[model samples]
Target: MKRTNEKIAEQFKTFQILDEEGKVVNEEAMPKLSDDELKELMTRMVYTRILDQRSIALNRQGRLGFYAPTAGQEASQLGSQFALEKEDFILPGYRDVPQLIWHGLPLYKAFLFSRGHYIGNQFPDGVNALSPQIIIGAQYVQTAGVAMGMQKRGQKSVAITYTGDGGTSQGDFYEGMNFAGAFNSPAIFIVQNNRFAISTPVEKQTAADTLAQKAVAAGIEGVQVDGMDVLAVYTVTKEARERAVNGEGPTLIEMLTYRYGPHTMAGDDPTRYRSEELDNEWEKKDPLVRFRKFLEEKGIWSEDEENAVIERAKDEIKAAIKEADNTPKQKVTDLIGNMYETLPANLNEQMEEYKAKESK
Candidate 1:
């Protein structure tokens, strides 16, 4: 008999709705979305790309703090996010700020988050998301707990989380999947396999043929999708969410994608590890270009319309960064206060000391 992971790997072929040129490759897999909805998807992808570009500039100018570039993975980020309802819980990794913003986080707050402001961690009323997790793979376990809570409360919502290829190697990743599987929790796990976990290539991170096949170990549904195709990501995510809410348990989706920049805005360099030849190859499969082509073929999108969206996004991003800059400097006391409902004695003493120092 064949080994289990190999069987699972053979079953989990990469799914695609659109080819590299944005032409439909699988008509049967096309989602039932309206023309307006298709346009909306393109708008989000374009907006995210602009945001990524602006963020890189901000980081260089010292106007922003930590940032992970989302330039090439626009479809993977925005497409999966577009499939969820507002009531659903989002447990995102540090790079997933775009999803949180679209899910109701104010754009200004996202700027604040990257700036390390304490207020950035606070979610507004009715926003069902946690601040982006800085620790890799921690959100996976947290998502399991949040999904379990929703399951127990009989809420018709699912909890979804995303991590990069590097995150899949963490112990927490497997533990979260196992717990969610055992309890039949309503969770959707997405691994954005962008070929690198920082400087480490994904192949070095695991022995499995594909990240999706790891789902077999937990006895859950698994799939690989063309992450550069927005429609494909949206369709697969929607199906996974539906299954989760219906109590069919969790699904692990591996997005075959790439990031077009350094792992972070910090001192790390991508050129050292990734080759220009490889970069050019992925550039041809750029998500925005592919999706825009598809929308153009449908006669629902034009250059003028896309330009208008880009201008609007620039305006929004400018205002948000201004707001973030106007925010009062975060105090040490503020961090401590947000850390606990009731401060422990030692923390209380430190908070009082910081308050006194702040007052002076």
Candidate 2:
């Protein structure tokens, strides 16, 4: 007899191994890593936080054109990103800079992207990540196509895509999920449910009780995880990657987390949509803070180590900014040229105009 007792489709439960106070609620369920590995996770979280802060400051200074802040969702993004293979393709949304960086996108290239420079579109030779998709749920469809290609070639490489709670609402989200499911494609879909999709909160976005359940219609497995717990996220994502590479299928993960700042650097006031008290309450469960405490307990982290890591992060970010500054500016003609092998008449005319102007 087929059982229907609390399946993922029937009811999605938030998976968590760690508590807010850095204590393991389920020791067996927690991912076991060496001291060095644990320390790496802590370091990456700190680095991501610093990077997010730096980008926010740069945006405010009019140095960046458009950037999304990924402050409180470090564990959600980084932990999953760490689980992927080097050859895996990453289809990222705008708020997923840390993941993009982890997937071989240089820090400077990401900065250039925020600055609206064309150089950001170019990835390192071996890196398989794409530039962040500005359209909300567009990456979903893109990832599906990529996964389909990987499957046809019988390559172990998979395509992992990320979206927000808002992305789940788009038609592309369903279409992508459905296509992957039908083909049993090698793809992983991650939903970083950071409570708010811009000014609109998740509660208002859908009537569904859990975002993970959305995968049911697509005939794929989905689960909800504590986005604040790096270990839990790493475990789930690593297992998901293995399954995809092994030809099991795609999975949808909904990470329950919060965004501590405004949705974007476009001057949207988070305060107008949410309360200070709510933000303060969520701060108690900050991913970096909790992970740092865990590492300290393992005797792998200390005040000195933490300080050094912070300084290193700052230096790395400084170097990225310098690299971006030193790079040549984006050209109008290049933009028009890169779009297609055969350009339309209007774009050709525009490119010619720019070329003539540049020749002056």
Candidate 3:
């Protein structure tokens, strides 16, 4: 055969409704959101970034542990989660704590979870979020099963899972996406392609051209969006949720974004593998800066408004920290009590022995 190009142009272009300067690129595809609604979206994005900043600082100060920073990925995470209904379920990865909080996980509980406390997994009634998954790509399979269960119960809601570019390489990713397509499960998969799976560049992870196209083999609709553009991500996710609940089956979304910091607070360094030029380039397309520009132009946002939002988020974080600190620490007894429906005599005795020693 002669050297020739295959039919690949159809999926090469990235789908983005908003541009870097906060202008809507496609008017027809623009979401019909009001001024207040738009401000609310920007507020959440700002809040998440601030939260990340504060939490990372806390971790550095030895007050917290095990955090995956979400600084540059606010648009992809918050935008998609904002599109979901309250009844919808979420299966988030370590970096999706912001989305988990939006879905009802309290900020303090998130902090507790980061600190390795069991109470961190606890949530008040009516909250439909799951504990953050540290194991990569596991949420995909879990989401598929949850969606199937919802259908069996005749519920009208859907289940959404998030992963990264590296997660697409996991077998669980394929299994989950394929199961959803085959069974018509109400599951939406969000792949935040932040260009690096930890310190490894995404190009080294796969040669599939785009992470969105990974869904094609599963017979699902896949689209790539500007993950830095909040409007574009929200639009795509909202459409996908509607399609899922309307019995149209699954959709895969690849959000093109970047992570400004390390993969985790523990043992990674961005500067070790990435360059200042690349970081500066991505900094220009920051989700918060672009959205703020648009809202300021629309006369719906101002320096005062932004500062107020920041103050509000900081206050909330402070209150959450206080609440978390005041919470009764998880004891040795809870470990045995929560492990089984009926406690075995030997384990119960051991738990009581430890409890007695602690009381003394």
The lDDT of each candidate is 0.93, 0.89, 0.89
Per-candidate TM-scores read 0.97, 0.95, 0.96
Model 1 reaches what TM-score against the true structure?
A: 0.97
lDDT per residue as tens, model 2, 14-124: 899889988889888877678888888888898889888988888888877798888999999999988888999999999987888877888999889888888888898
Scored by lDDT, the top model is 1
For every candidate structure, what is the RMSD over all alpha carbons to the true structure, in angstroms? 1.5, 2.6, 1.8
Q: Which ten residues in a row have the lowest lDDT in candidate 1?
A: 1-10
TM-score pick, better of 2 and 3? 3
lDDT of 1 by residue, 1-360 (tens): 348657767898999999999999999999999999999989988988899999999999999999999888989999999999989999999999999988999999999899999888888999999999999999999999999999999999999999999999999999999999999999999999999898998879887889998998999999999999999999999999999999999999999999998899889889999999999999999999998889999899999999999999999999999999899999898889988999999999999999999999
Model 3: which residue pairs collide? none
lDDT of 3 by residue, 8-111 (tens): 42564687877889887888988888888899999999999999999999889888889999999999999999898999999999999999898888899999
Worst 10 residues of 2 by lDDT: 1-10
Score residue 356 of candidate 3 by CA lDDT: 93
Candidate 2 accuracy as TM-score? 0.95
Candidate 2 has an lDDT of 0.89
- lDDT of candidate 3 at residue 263, scale 0 to 100: 93
